[model samples]
Target: MLDFFIQPFFEFAFMKRALVACFALALGSAPIGVILMLRRMSLFGEAMSHAILPGAATGFLIAGFSLPAISIGGVIAGLVVVLAAGAATRATDQREDASVAAFYLIALALGVALISMRGSSVDVMHILFGSVLAVDEAALLLLGVVSSVSLALLAALYRPLLLDGFDPDFLRSLRGTGGGTLYHLIFLGLVVVNLVAAFQALGTLMAVGLMMLPAVTARFWARSLPGMMAVAALIAAVSGYAGLLLSFHANLPSGPAIVLACGAFYILSLFFGRVQGILLRLLPTRHLEA
Candidate 1:
């Protein structure tokens, strides 16, 4: 069993790279997902995930999968959507959700069109599905850089972001002049950076799986914000390690396998988690019957 757990990662270079990439992704993206979930923006975050694709597709079109080009294009595309959404929400009576949805749809269609013109159907699928086992040194480096930047910024903005997360209307009243626009931009920037990094390892579609599932899972077990973040990170790391093992043994795709591992944890937690698990509810029922 130890060999079963240890051999593939020990023997294969690509597996090692995949493991590192997954952990880095988990470290960076999971916290952001937690915060987004707290702010009730999971659907917007999902839309933003697709929103990065047009730029990534454009980067692929122009640069043929070069790391820098793709990352840059994705960041640019994400920023455009965020900025546009922010402005639209501010200027009109339209809700941010509606505006964000509109931008995401436009971006998704443009991304699809761009990919079709640039390469085969396989390329589009690759953009959507990803190839984590194939993550190379350059991709790993990109992930590391993004992770470092995201974590650093998260620490710096912790207090403001926390206030914004829970008491945003009050926060807005205090900050004045549109209230925390800069911090909000920084938040969006971190989200896009993480998304771009995840795009390399998991693609746009699969990327959010790692980010969101762990967060949702954490919510089942954790009471405080910090507890949720810590638990989510641990869950994400475990999911990465276990998913890699499954990918090696079962010949599964690494990205989706990792996500499915997260889903498994989620399902188990839904029924058996300490804080909000369904089993806890049953305990009360059983007690009343007794």
Candidate 2:
């Protein structure tokens, strides 16, 4: 088993890249995901995941599987979705969620149509499911750069972002203007870009799961934001490693296996978490006599 586990790292460059990319993704997405959940933007992440499909398809058509081109196109489409959703909310008083859902559905359909027009169904399946086992050195470098920049940005904006996450109303009231809400928009755009970059390795759906599940599970264990982020990153990293091992051993799809491992952690957290476990929920309530 140990030999089996160590063999991939020693034998394959692609496996090495897969491990590095997953590590970078675990670090990059977990903290951002925690913030997103706190700020009630979890759905927005899901929306952006679906919304970038059209851009990816367009990029594929134009650049023939160029990673940077596809990533840029996805990022642009993400920004458009955000802008359009914001505008629609302002113009019609519609709920942001409704707009997001509409955009997601439209973009997904369009992306599929474009891919079909240009490539075979097998290519579409690969796009939707991903090819994480085949991740290259260039892709790993791209993931590293993006993850580093994102982590730096998150660190720089930590205070303001937390303030906005916890109490947007208070922040807005304190500032005369929207308290530079536009910055939040840009941050979300960056999240989309990271998601797109990760899509080739994790796929759109499983990428969303990876981004959200670890953070969600960590929330059950930690009281502070920093603690949550740390726990989430740890869980994600461990899950990535374990999932890759399982996939290599079992000959399963790496992306899906990783996501399933993350899901297992989520389920475990639900039952065993210190702060919000089922056992805690079942404990007797204390009463104070008046």
Candidate 3:
């Protein structure tokens, strides 16, 4: 049992690197996930993940799988979509969700077309579903930098974020005209950065899973915002470990395996979590005297 769990990381450099990458990703991305869930922008993270594809494909075209180039491209592309979506929402009758959905769909199709122009299906699979074993020192460094920056920004913007989550109108009123906008932009930027970081370990599609699933599960388990963030982070890190081990032993794809692990947690939380799980909700309640 010990060797099965410990030997992989103990003996293999790639495994060690992958584990560290997952932990770092969870630390930064999980809290952001909580905020997104609270703000009912859960799908926004998914849209942003797909939005990264065009930039990453552009990077692949320019540098042939160079990590930095891909990351930089992804960041630029994701941020552009975010800003564009916001601008469109403000300018048009369409809501923010509709604008974001439209942009991501276009971005996704464009990204695939660009990658197909230069590479084969195998390359596309590699980009869309990453191989954790391919993680290198540069990728590790990028993950660390992104995670650190995300945590710092989240801390600095906590008050505004809390307000945005609970009462957007109140937050806007408190900040006055255009007050909450900066924080919203910053929050989206953090989401983009973390998604890029996870892109190194998990592919574009699976990356959002790590960010959102744990948060969704945490909602069932934790009542407070801080508690939800903590539980989500913990679930993400644990899922990373379990998923890596499952991949090592069963020859599964690393990214999807990790995501599946998160999915499993979600299922369990839905049935058994303390806050409002199906089981708990179905149980009989004791009568109370008024």
In order, what lDDT does every prediction score?
0.90, 0.83, 0.92
User: Against the hidden true structure, what lDDT does model 1 obtain?
Assistant: 0.90
Candidate 2 segments exceeding 4 Å error:
284-290
TM-score of each: 0.95, 0.94, 0.97
Candidate with the greatest TM-score versus the true structure: 3
User: How many clashing residue pairs are found in candidate 3?
Assistant: 0
Expressed as tens digits, the lDDT of each residue in 29-64 for candidate 3 is 999999999889999999999999999999999999
Off by over 4 Å in 1: 285-290
Best by lDDT: 3
CA shift at 176, candidate 3, in angstroms? Answer: 1.8
Better of 1 and 2 by TM-score: 1
Q: What is the C-alpha RMSD of each candidate to the true structure, in Å?
A: 2.2, 2.2, 1.4
lDDT of 1 by residue, 66-153 (tens): 9999999999999999999888998999999999999999999999999999689889888998999989999999999888888888
Candidate 2 TM-score, true structure as reference: 0.94
- In model 3, the runs with Cα more than 4 Å from the true position are 288-290
**Looking at model 2, which ten-residue stretch has the lowest summed lDDT?**
281-290
Question: What lDDT score is found at residue 163 in candidate 3?
Answer: 89
